[model samples]
Structure formats: structure tokens, C-alpha cells
Target: MHNLYIPVIAILAAFAIIFGGQAISDSRVDDEIKSLISKQLGVDGEIELQAMKEVQKGYGVCGQYQVADQGQRFVPFYYSKVNERVTLDADAERYRRHCGS
Candidate 1:
């Protein structure tokens, strides 16, 4: 029926908006993570972002980075959206001590 179709369309539209918003949020956070890492390591290129997940304040990002032929290194970082800061480590001692990991 026409009324049934309306509800279906509304549900689909809601889903689209929710998913689209989340994707845009993730992309922005990922870009921020890359910039923070670049600044911290003093390198602009060779950053390979592998994974990212939402955390309490911001996100937990993991990636591989190569610095001036030093070979690729696996790194994890925590970016705090609330404080607008980044730290090295997301689930380790150092991060726990500093940012509750």
C-alpha cells in the first residue's frame, strides 16, 4: 500500500543519514590522526593507516610508518577529541598512565 511504502522510505532515509554521518565523522578523524602523526614524527609521507575505532574521547588508530629508510614500524595512537591532543599508544602502559588507555 501507499502508506506502507512511506514508512519504508522513511526508514531507508534514516539509515542513509545515520550511516553517511558516521562515515564523514570517521574520515575527518582519520585525517586528523594522520596530521598528528606526521607532526609527531616530523614526516609527511609514508604514513599507512591500517585501522581506526572510536574511543572514549576520540579514536584509537593503528598504522605502519616508514621514516627515511628506517623501515616500516607499526604504531598505535590515541587521539583525544575532547582535549585536542594525541598520544603514542592506545592500550599500553604509557597510554594508561597518561590517558586511561
Candidate 2:
């Protein structure tokens, strides 16, 4: 019975370690993504960060922000580290126009 318990505990421990590692990895990825997005968007001051669900793609962070002009109307943007690119959707053409390639 003790040996059976030991194996079960080992399996549980392994799973916990795997899950913890994954969580850490995910947090790091999120932080990096946030930093890149903020830089690209020229978000210097304190920002109300939000992850937009509608524009989200695999391994990318997508979101919108309301500028002084828009007054709570969020304009969409995309950030992807894999591609090292940030893109604003058509609705955000004003922002995109200012951001030269």
C-alpha cells in the first residue's frame, strides 16, 4: 500500500511541476508581449491594459485603446513576437498612418 501511494504521489508531483512550469512560461510570454505592444504603440504613461478577444490570433496579443479623440471607442491593434510586427486594423488607420514602417 505504501509503494502504491508513493507512485501516485510521484505522478501528482510530476504533473504539478509541469503545470507550474507552463504557468511561468505563459506569464513570461505575456509580459514580453505587453512590453512590445506598449513600445510599438508609444504608450508612455500609465495604461489600462486589456486583452481583446475578438482580434486575438494564435500566439498574438490583440487589443484596443481609446485615445483623447475617440472617447472610449477602442481602436484595434495586433502584436506578434514571432513575426516581430505590430499592426493596427483598418479602423485604426489614423494611428497606422502615423506609425511609419
TM-score of each: 0.71, 0.57
Q: Enumerate residue pairs that collide in model 2.
A: none
lDDT of each structure? 0.65, 0.58
Which stretches in model 2 have alpha-carbon errors above 4 Å? 46-74, 90-101
Backbone clashes, candidate 2: 0
lDDT of 2 by residue, 6-61 (tens): 88999999999999998897667556655665676676543344555322335555
**What digit string (tens of lDDT, one per residue) describes model 1 on residues 37-95?**
78887876756566455555343433333343456666666666765567765566645
Q: What is the lDDT of candidate 1?
A: 0.65
- Looking at candidate 1, the ten consecutive residues that score lowest on lDDT are 57-66
Which candidate number would show the highest lDDT if scored against the true structure? 1
Model 2: how far is 44 from its true place, Å? 3.0
CA-RMSD of model 2: 6.4
